[model samples]
Target: MATVQFKGIVKKFGDNLVLNGVDVDIKDHEFVVIVGPSGCGKTTLLRMLAGLEEITDGEILIDNLLVNELHPSKREIAMVFQDYALYPHMTVEENMNFALRLRKMDKAEIASRVAEASNVLQLNKFLKRMPKQLSGGQRQRVAIGRAIVRKPKVFLFDEPLSNLDAKLREEMRVEIAKLYQRLNATIIYVTHDQVEAMTLAGRIVIMNHGIVQQVGSPIEVYRKPCNLFVAGFIGSPTMNFMTGKLALEGEALFFKNEDIKLSIPPYLLSDAKKHDGREVVLGVRPDDVLVERDGEKCSDKVQGVLEVCELLGHRENLYLKVGGMRVLATVEAFFNRSPGSAVTLCFNYKNMHVFDKATESRISE
Candidate 1:
């Protein structure tokens, strides 16, 4: 186990800058996930840490030791690549022990390490199997096994499950979680999938355009996003955003847009009068959009026409049109409402978010 640190990390490819002044501290035995969209430099950062990419300016410290100029083989870190970089001709056992063999380790010691990793990954039966003979999930497990045999201070996974089907990915996620518990090793995972970040990470590092957006537990990021991008990126089904302006009317602050108007709760923004006539964006999740049902009315409910209903087993998604704006609401299965039906919906203020339009930063508590 080891603590990893990136201090003022920067990378450049000739005239193009990929990462700029990125800083993150990963604690010993922590499962930290770096996640963002494509071309965000998440993988590039990981490669820098692994010595696969050069650092234009900055320091990488592993276990409190400066490793900026250290060779990748001396970093004491094993990386599981996105494509499951296994030797095509080598058997699983051969691939797992290749590093040890390169070091000219004792035969008995190499065999013991291989056996231990095989048992941990349940790959004993596939030890003699070649990479092409195994399934996608099995090959990924072998790649991980190769890393495990090294007993490195840190484990880096670069989207190791992206090549698998959804069902296999789910199963591998559980396997990796269990492996973490058994090893209690420092793990850094990189992926573009927010679901993977939210479910597997002890702490998530959200990055965009080479800048770190937020670092916190999944619940912390989900419940209280720092800005508009964090608010929109970390959740499922995406959050619905309504752009408008805030106007102080008699003591209450109201948000007015072309499609609808909503009163901002005092607790959400205490100094309401100070933000009078300010452009802002209101954010609400699909699950937080309350729809009128069972003859019950919602506070500040606005009328809309249901445009579509998508049934997703245990839940249903309602697409509604209010004026010219579109809104999505996730509700219990069998909403029993057909398209074109008139529906009234309101936001759950407890989970509402308000952002300053100019800075794209959250303004509400």
Candidate 2:
């Protein structure tokens, strides 16, 4: 397996700048997931690496060697697309071994390689099945098995599971993770699903508007987002942003917006202290809010009326209207809660996320 790097990569489609000076490095043998909303250039980046798209400007390095001009087949990489792209007339084993046969590899060598790949993807039982005869997950596995048979130095997955049903997508995600472990190959997977990015990636690269927003581990990026785009993009329920003004009340700092005035947790005050009286954005995740009478460690409390309540078995999501702002809070699944009741809630000081009102960048020490 080889490490991959993109330096100052840029792409444009007839004046629409798609990738803007993007730079990223994928460690050897690492499973890196690139996530962004549609048309954020995530797939464009992958296509550039695969030599499928011509990058307008930049360097692409595989194993520290410049490969911007390298042909797709010469780059020592295999790509699996969202579509299975299987041969309708060929059996699973034939599809898996087609590339080798084209390269004129010995028949015995091709058979051994195909058998090994089938075992890795658990497709041994489906070797005789044609594309139309197998299920979606099985066909996807066959796609992966074909890639593995080639022993490519790097693997690229372009939303390969998008074609599967939700349940099958989740199952295939685990299967893909296991395949990565068995092969130990560098992988670049592009997906819009945050759940897949969070679960499969060793590192998550979040992009927006053709620019890279942030790159960090799933937890790090989730807890400490680089900018407003990332804070809003990477999580399931999405972090809540309240427009507010940063103010100094005596020796302490607080952000007051609309009817809510929240103190900047002391530990985080260091960054906002100098900019007292300036405006800033307050961010908090739904999971960080606690129900009434929940704790004593909360920094502030709000009295809100639940406008909508959803029971999720493991937890309940309460959508409340605190003045003009709509706040979503998650409570224990067993907690008895209903709409129209007024409830007091608190949030931990350490859980608050603050951003610069002007630049929208996170105010982190």
- TM-scores for all predictions: 0.98, 0.97
Q: Candidate 2's residue-wise lDDT over 71-112, tens digit each?
A: 898999998988979999999999999989999999999999
The regions of model 2 sitting more than 4 angstroms off are: none
Every candidate's lDDT: 0.93, 0.88
lDDT of 1 by residue, 1-365 (tens): 89999999999999888898899999999999999998889999999999999899999999999999999999999999999989998999999999999999999999999999999999999999999999999999999999999999999999998999999999999999999999999999999999999999999999999989999999999999999999999999999999999999999999999989888888888998799999999999999898884222233878999999999999999998999999999999999988999998888888889999999999999
Give the number of the best model, judged by lDDT: 1
Q: With candidate 1 superimposed using the best TM-score fit, by how many Å does residue 105's alpha carbon deviate from the native?
A: 1.4
Q: Against the true structure, what is every candidate's RMSD?
A: 1.6, 1.3
